[model samples]
Target: MIRRIFPYPVLSVGFFATWLLFNQSVTPGQLILATFFGVTSPWLLVRLDAPPFRMRRPLMILRVLWTFAKDIAQSNLRVAKTIIASPHPPPSGFVRIVLEMRSPYGLAALACIVTGAPGTAWISYDPVDNVVVLHILDLMAEDDWAASIKTRYEKPLMEIFE
Candidate 1:
């Protein structure tokens, strides 16, 4: 019953906070409306049969976020350099990366991290074979790219989600 009332606590809190922020003042009408929407949305979502997520390591999630931020900054600089150096055109292509992390949340995080980076974009994911196709703005060496992704992103994601 309690779970049904608040199926997604984080989402509910976010919706409520957004509502208050948008209104600029938390009047009774706004509060009631936000509460009703937040509570009802979760109940409707629950009917769609979503599995519960278990976050294994909260600290590791923080670490992943920090690492991702650093990578994004570095990639942005690298892409900028490649773009400015017109003599040597960037070798951009798609590469399939075999994934080891099995958790849905981990995969979702990985997708966001890859797509968020300026030089790299996630194209598609194969759930059956656990592989992801990514397009890089500059492709130097496939082996090097795969190794770096595994070491830099996949390793931390494995620790956090798996």
Candidate 2:
């Protein structure tokens, strides 16, 4: 009985919370509408085929989040300094990293992390080769950047998702 009503309970709760936060009201009508949409959207979305997701180590997720946040802040500072100090702009280049992570979800999360931080953008990823091409604003050491991504972010994500 409960399963039928809440096919995706987590998604339903997220939707309801997001609606309330966006609307910024707790009126009867608002609650009714949020509840209706929250319950319905998940049911509709469940039809789509999604990859199997399982967190092997839940505690590692927090570590990944913290590392990502720190990297973003550091990257912002580095980029800002480069922009302010450099009269002749540093040469920007693309670095192709050979990745060992095979999980689609893990790869997607890595894409977000790499692209979200300043000065770096995800150019393209070759799933067949398991290689990610990244465009960096200030390309100093190609090997160092690749190592940093693998050690700082990719490794943690692998632990959590794979």
Scored by TM-score, the top model is: 2
C-alpha local distance difference test of each model = 0.85, 0.92
**C-alpha lDDT of residue 123 in model 1:** 96
On residues 9-121, what C-alpha lDDT tens digit does candidate 1 reach at each position?
Answer: 98888888887888898889999988887777666767777556777777987777888889889998988888886677888998899989988888888889899999899
Report the Cα lDDT for candidate 1: 0.85
The ten-residue window of minimal lDDT in model 2 covers: 44-53
lDDT of 2 at 91: 86
- Clashing residue pairs in candidate 2 (N, C-alpha, C atoms within 3 angstroms): none
- Could you give the C-alpha RMSD of every candidate to the true structure, in order shown? 2.5, 2.2
After the best TM-score superposition of candidate 1, give how far the Cα of residue 122 lies from its true spot, in angstroms: 1.1
TM-score of 2: 0.84
